[model samples]
Target chain A: MSDTLRPNSSDDNQGAQPLYVPIKRRSFFMYAGATAGATALLLTGCKDDDDSSIDAKTTVDVGVGDVGVLNYAYALEQLEAAFYAEVLKGGYFTGLAPAAAERQIFADIALHEQIHADFFKTALAGNAIKALTPNFSAINFGDRTSVLTSARAFEDLGVAAYNGAGRFITDPKFLVVAGKIVSVEARHAAIIRDLITPNSFVANDVIDFSTTSATARQERSKLPAEVLAVANTFLAESSKVSAKSLV
Target chain B: MKLLSLLDRLSTADAPAAAAPRRDLLHRLGQAGARAAVAALPLAAALPAQAAPTDTTLDAILLLLKLEDMLVALYTQALASPALAGAAQAAVRPDFERMLRHQQGHAQFYRTTLLTAGLTPPAAPRFDFSGRRNNAGNPELFPNVLNDYNAFLQLAQQLEDASASIYLNQVAAFATDRQLRDVVLRTQLVEARHASHVRTLRRTATASVAVKSWPSNADVVPSPAVVVPSPAGASTPPVSIYSFEANEVQLVSATTAVPFLAVLTGATAVQFVALSEAFDEPLPTAQANALLNIFG
Candidate 1:
């Protein structure tokens, strides 16, 4: 989450650039059970809010291995799949109705979101995030402009979510699957941005092809805590209270 | 009869593939997953273990389909462009169509794969490259993607880039399916080559490469002076507006540097490579978008 800091509170985080805030990338990973670590994080989330609190619960007991991390991801996928299913239940609002290209893009994006949700459900099976409810109250779906703005934000966050998490999967096989999913999510992000304004897919701030020089491919992304925070804002009150870290 | 003809057309157009039995098995499994394949993906670490030669057959074919779609879309736009002169078209057309046909074969391979496995190939959509439904009178009219060369190419670059990124990452991901991963890498290299070529055209026709560079950090439409693709080393490549890692080792790659979306989505701390040399910083999706929107 520190890889790129957010100027505003994670909840109010709208459009802050990497330049303004400095997020330190968490590079250290001691060999620990991925599933256990996730459970600890989630249990931490489930416990009454406390900065310094340690209690034991029947957490998803997992061995310290790549498989543990995978199960952790599987858990998040469950959350994500369940989240989008509810968002599109009534279908996204037609923001750029006059722009058929944009509308079509939105529809495709919705399908992609649903597919992503389903994919996780299938991959995780029982371990998938319990069909938990999402909280999008902060989003003004009635206001097309506001909604698109938020969609742009969420899509990008979704892509970054994958980017920030990729390295954790030690297994080459799972890493590959992660990559496949990230691209689709990225595509969704691009299309949504393009819908808002054409040719505005990957701006200079994001792409960095240079090798010898600095600032090559440093776009931006959101942290798990931040992502979960926003996800909670959009969810019901109960979910927010129980919302734990998906990172 | 139509189905048989379609199959023949697909077969004749396919690049020389491998042994029939082996190829058939790969195709069958690939088709079974179909739409279910990429339905859901995490941010960075989605690569699963299908890379093993045993079950990776489906992943291999799907990767082919993904690559083929990207290539077809790229060529359809490039070839259709009136500005693209003679020799380039004459030279690039077959290869482009060949890419499309390859996808057709891959798609068929998946279908056959499903049949052999006693499953059904998922229904695919008739893709609209134009990015438009051609309903000019419709209230929500999208750009006639075919007519609007700019937007089409924009998408083409993204898709090609996505393909290239995935291919690059799969290099190291695929364990058992070494040969299949190699084939995908080859396609990925081809796509990268394709991206470079498209970039060159963008420079020649309209704005400089800089202008074409996507996810522009501007609220207003950028001026031609924005200048992109400056001497390759001038500016750092920004993070892709989008990302993916393929591989049940679907994104199995040759190097440790997995694909962009893979790195971004399911990326582990160990796999977190600094995106560009300039900004020692690694921005996530939210941070990146927030910055862009500020300028927007």
Candidate 2:
């Protein structure tokens, strides 16, 4: 189980290169406004070299450092918020009784995800990434099993993403805020899992429960690159996100 | 004072003879002092001149170890209680078992982390879930915690919620070691999962006790019937685990709030509830210790 959970080293190596170096340069200019003349010249020289080999349209790098981590989270939240918004309008939700627990649950979660997405946008301000377009063609929201299974995947992935990204945040305040949000994501994941199949909230798949070690019940976290691989599937090609610098 | 003394013992009991030099301890204390000074600038003049020793990483680990130890004892005893032996609880017994296993794992993790750092964790406390401080003469704040399923679930929900808050409070203190910080983050989410599961159980079991999977202002306040007396003999309000959870405004800095109400506008009431429920507030270490001491 641990072997499978171990991050793919080769994938991580691929993620180490800055595929979206231009994005970072663009945001840096937006954030710093007018830099000193000498500094601007040095930055432009480096920018041209980065643009020569990489097509920025093909992939969206979340940037680097704390901003990259924030964008990584922002990207995931956007996906969740979009998925839940679609779920609310789908046949399955509309078909349920107005007062049904499932309906209320979906409504509450929709609000939560939107709150998360909007919060990141506000917090990041100028450094925030443009909203990515969601591609939910794979999801049949009219069906309960399909919508819920996708929800469970997103919630679990969100939790793992935040958990894994914590070490990368240099700012204590950001880490603290991330801590506040990740638990809510965990709560959502648990309830979603429970709704799908009772008593599976802390199942072995999301949590390490290997018998070889008595103390191996920690929750498993996924690196940013690992999370993006699954998240990009629900995102449109042009809007697909990457965390190359995050690795 | 009892709680403070107990924490003092837990913080100091396992120190090795070859502890860090006094100068090093003072240096760490100075850093903590600066942080506390900034945090308490408004009240600095009114406060005492002598500063107490601030929590180090070692203290944080020990405090969490103490918390996990109490949780493990609570779940272990509850599983054995005849109150949960009936058919209704039979369906949820697996949940209890799984939660217990995770808590035991957490406790072991903290203990091992301490040992790895060359510090010994203190022995687990004898937990009394009735909130009597293990004294028969004292008033029982949670009378049916072990005998009634509803009572058990109520206490369990609060404990789990408090556990998540306590972990959040300590995460930033571990910034010096990113690996340890990430581990704390991982463990903290599991605690949140546990809290959500317990809250869900409560919501489904009894409609009378209003609760959502996440903390919300709409949830009924889980207060003790009797106000416990402070050591000073004044009636102390019951220690609430969710005391700070109903905060709607979040601060990105000292002066500015996240402005959730203005930004996420709709029905004012619904927005207010969502704003508060969106973020779980951190419990101060002193408050957490006080809450834990209720079950000492």
Candidate 3:
């Protein structure tokens, strides 16, 4: 049993080995086995952190790789979904223009966010992090101005987050999924912006000035850290998402 | 030997036959030099292989650049039209100018990218929005795209919507290059915004216009522009721009059709329009290219 557990000491004695043998093959398998073992340990070590019973004050590390980015997205979706769900429950705020249009758009947007949140939840399955609790105490759900303004902020932040995180995603399918979802977020962003101020959908504030063309402008992209910093302000201590591993 | 091995690895997966013709691929390699190929191996591994037969980076970039160039020309012509700057549409001239600037900027960006890739960017084609192909002999499809503001808005809405779909079509092909994918996706959404804004402009201009911020089933609504009658000896009837957008069914995956009405938790047939509006479908590459040929 002791010999079985020990490293192959004989294999390390290069002088005794045949000179014509391929050394690279043995080393490759040895590294592959070590990596597989480390990966298993890393995954298991983070399982408890993903539990639903996570304390509100706990700092949750959205672990690296595809799962990490999806969770990061999940957290934002959860926040937006919760916000819209609450807004719909309370009814449209006063002073909302074209009341019927606003109500319908808001309802549709709320459903879209909820669907996005649920989709990520299903995709991550057992690896998904705890449901984030958004702290919207400061936002007045009764006022159309406040609610729409908050929606704009959330939609813009969501767009920026997805745009910024695109480069970090390693899987092509995951990136395609992100692309599918991000455009919806963008459409939502445009609608919310236009609702707030007509024709200001892609205003310079949210879009960076174009250096490539004198007249062309591009939408702004935010790094994970910058986005999370803004996002955490609306999230409670326990539900705060950390993308340190992702970056 | 290492270079030969590198070539072998790259070709094996994609070769049509054991000894596939690779003149273009080999020419690219020859131009890149042997040292660059050696350096590019690790980077090449990061590029996601696409299954589409013609979705090469050069093709995607060239197509996108052409689309942008067409847009720049369209907007420039619209802004230049004395009718647009007159009293009837005077208030919206600044907005049209803004749109023109964005298209010009987009066109410039695409040109720079092509040049940076060491490819010669195609020259701007003489665009005839009248759809007469600059030849009086050909029948006109869009007769009032530039002179009439309402007609202009309708055409603008169609172009912007088409732009969004075209970008969506090409975006997946860029998956291999993270930087390019990022740029494409970011730019794609801006097109979406532009589409929405154009739709709003149309709706505002005509209270009865059946358009929405997002595309609805009403996408099938007949357009005032683009009356393409089949010529005397034509085989296939030309597809109208509005007809292209009025699609309800969409593919959520390669094989799965999104059950829009079933999955959409709402009431009545009107809500089906909302379901359609909820997702924009991608237009196929061949169709998109065909549409691009109309203005030039």
Best by TM-score: 2
Interface RMSD, candidates in the order listed: 14.4, 3.3, 5.2
Candidate 1 regions exceeding 4 Å error are A1-99, A208-215, A218-223, A240-247, B1-162, B165-296
TM-score of each: 0.40, 0.80, 0.74
Query: How do the candidates rank by lDDT, highest first?
Result: 2, 3, 1
TM-score for candidate 3, residues paired by index: 0.74
- Look at candidate 1 and tell me the lDDT of residue B52: 20
**Residue by residue across A66-185, what tens digits does model 2's lDDT show?**
888988899999999899989988999999998787887888888888888878887787778777889999999999999999999999999989977887898767887888888899
- Give the Cα error of residue B235 in candidate 1, in Å: 46
lDDT of 3 at A144: 79
Q: What share of the true interface contacts does candidate 2 keep?
A: 0.68
Index of the highest-DockQ prediction: 2
Q: What is the TM-score of chain A in candidate 3?
A: 0.74
- On lDDT, the candidate that comes out on top is 2
Report the C-alpha lDDT of model 2 over B70-135, residue by residue, as the tens digit.
999998999999657777789889999999999988888877765544445689999999977888
- Full candidate order by DockQ, most accurate first: 2, 3, 1
What proportion of the true contacts does each candidate reproduce? 0.03, 0.68, 0.34
- Return whichever of 1 and 2 wins on DockQ: 2
